[model samples]
Target: MAKQSTLDKNILHFLGPKHWLTWLGMGIAYALSFLPWFIQKFLGKALGNLHRALSPNRRHICDVNLHMCYPEMTIKERQSLTKAHFESMGIGVFEMFATWFQDRSKTISKVSFHNEDVVEKALSKGKGCIIIGAHFSSIDLCGTHMARYIDVHPIYKLQRNPVMNWVMERQRRKIFSKTIERRNVREVIKSLKQNKAVWYAVDQDYGRKNSVFAPFYGHECATISHISRLAKSTQAAILLYDYGRTEKGYFLSLTELEDYPTGDEVQDATKINQLIEQQIEPKKAQYFWSHRRFKTQAIEGTPSPYSK
Candidate 1:
């Protein structure tokens, strides 16, 4: 954990003002979202053109993810999907700014919910539940919508930009007072004990020691152990929540993972990984393919070209 913290600190230092660039980009994106529907649509289309012109390294990451998850897809099919993926990414960028900048009531009104009873049931149990989500199409909006039903304490990895981080923290704190840092395990556990729902994006690559290798899209990747440990320790019900984009905007789907493994740590973590993959399979384009998901590979062999 100490090593991972050091690594994150170093990476943050290296990235430096790149975080400000993201905020600047987001500022433009947020303004674009409020444009006329036709204008927003046109901007989305233009993003596809820019994505197509990406250099080899950037394009390779997208290509590798597509090939790995959809091995049966022909090159043409994969390329088409990749383009669509970029278009969605562009839209998502704009959506994030819209979500953060817009009024909470307006943003929440744009999203609908299904199977909210699943959450109600978990809360009724008197033990706070862990809501496991991923980098799906409208993940940011999911947290906003969820705030209407329950107090969601989301753990976020702080960004490098002091100014932007201040803005984001203020925005999120409007809905969740318990927005703890990812490294603060103690605070997370305390929130769970208080029966407060906690949200986590467990799909990211947490280096070797902190994570165990688990199968995701037929590849063994490092999976975070915190979810399993938290669930077992606090006796918290685990729920899978994903946001799917629709013509109207976004909708949240909540499912109870009653079948989550509990005995063996390795098997338990793998079960969670599989559940995430299953949820994402139907909405492959919604998943964040641009992320380095397979950064840490299993031993005994090299990672496939598609890995990460």
Candidate 2:
């Protein structure tokens, strides 16, 4: 075996004691997974409520997002939504455990697909597919089930925790057709040109250079324009890929775009944002509100929504 680097040794030392807590939580989640589905769900709801109470910083972020997006709603209404979102997020943590370690067969059985034929039809053409993925709390679980149906090459970021990162990558490799690093633009384009399905999420704010200030829920949020470039360059189809967590399980779908890559980057980006809004509208609490979505302001001197 190769010798461990000093950094590796240090990471191991730091993680040695603390890692057990994560492992213990994983154990608890796994145990709960075997129980009746409703019971496990109840446990997740309880856990989420506890987390919402304890995690003030995250709750604050959610509050900011909800307030900005739903300006018409009363503070009380937003608070209620935030509470429910946290509960969904709490259950999502358990869902991650289920995606990574639960019986693949058992979890896979729970997922249902809608309008998947759209993806198949797109791929049937010579041009590849760009699956416009979004951040929902149960994204990992959704991706796992979606991979069972299509050979989706998902874009992912490296985990900060080295051991956990390795585990995550390994689990993804086992499930998805292929996993692409978020920064690998070349691979993404190549996959698209080769007529493969590449899943990409452009909702997060990545600052000024590569993004444009686009309207998302009436707010000028920084949205990536690279997706437009990719579509134009490869002439690939843009399909909306998102999942909703129902009382029974997850409902994942792929909705094809009619006139995307309209040769106007901002317009295409706006259309993408609109599609995302449509998906998140009905299931507001199910969407991933924990992210600092409006961090990058369109105005030069405006305050960031996330600035405390």
Candidate 3:
């Protein structure tokens, strides 16, 4: 918790004319928060279409990612998937509002879970559980909702904008037992030692240091080895936490990775990537294809596939 004086300073700083755009954006978010669900979704669709028109570079990134991951798909099919992905990302924006502003009880009530006992059984081991999250668009809501069921400690990267970071941190504090900074390994390990559920997103390209080249969607990806290291150090159980939005509601799934960490970091990373791949296979569009997941190359001096 920050001191009242610091918070006051931030509020005063954010009130300056230079931050008018931030204020306007936040105001729109607040206004959309009260709108009907269907109307909000309609606006999200419009936002998606606008993004597709204005963000050609991001669209190109998504196109390249989808093409590489799904080489068997036709060009038309990949484009369709890319468009749907932007829509999902747009919906995710509204979902961020629902998550940070909507009633916590209502949010938790809507999540229907399968194999929830898997989480309980893993926690029963008394070693804590590492909930491995991917870049699924539904994660913003699902991460917060999971806290209602378990004592969650989510690892987050700090936003570059100070005000934005403060706002998000304030909201996340309401759900997570403790929000761990991504760089603070000691705190993360300490949380695990206390038998707390620590959530981490493993599907990212973090370069060579502390990462290994592993197969993701049959392509070599620079996968982080920290999760495997954490599991090994704490003797904690690793569980894949995934969710999808259906016509009914959000379907959250928890599956324990059997015989994980195998004492081989690279092999464990590959297994983690495989698990994430399986989860997104059924709903490819929901996965975040806009990110440069294959940014890092396995071989030195090999040009990035996404580079122009």
Which candidate leads in lDDT? 3
Against the hidden reference, what TM-scores do the models get?
Answer: 0.85, 0.90, 0.94
Candidate 2 lDDT tens digits, 208-293: 88798779999888999988888787889888887879877789888888887888878887888998999898789988898889
Off by over 4 Å in 1: 1-30, 300-308
- By lDDT, the better pick of 2 and 3 is 3
The TM-score that candidate 1 achieves is 0.85
TM-score of 3: 0.94
Error of 3 at 200 (Å): 0.6
Which 10-residue span in candidate 1 carries the lowest summed lDDT? Answer: 1-10
lDDT of 2 at 67: 84
lDDT of 1 by residue, 33-67 (tens): 67755566567657755865765566788888778
Candidate 3 lDDT tens digits, 1-308: 33221222456766778778887887778778878778877787788778988999889889989888889999999988988898988888888888777766765656887887887798888899899969888788877777777788988877766566657777888778688888889988888788888889889888888699889988999999888878888999988888887775688778888888898988988888888888888888889899999999999789988889
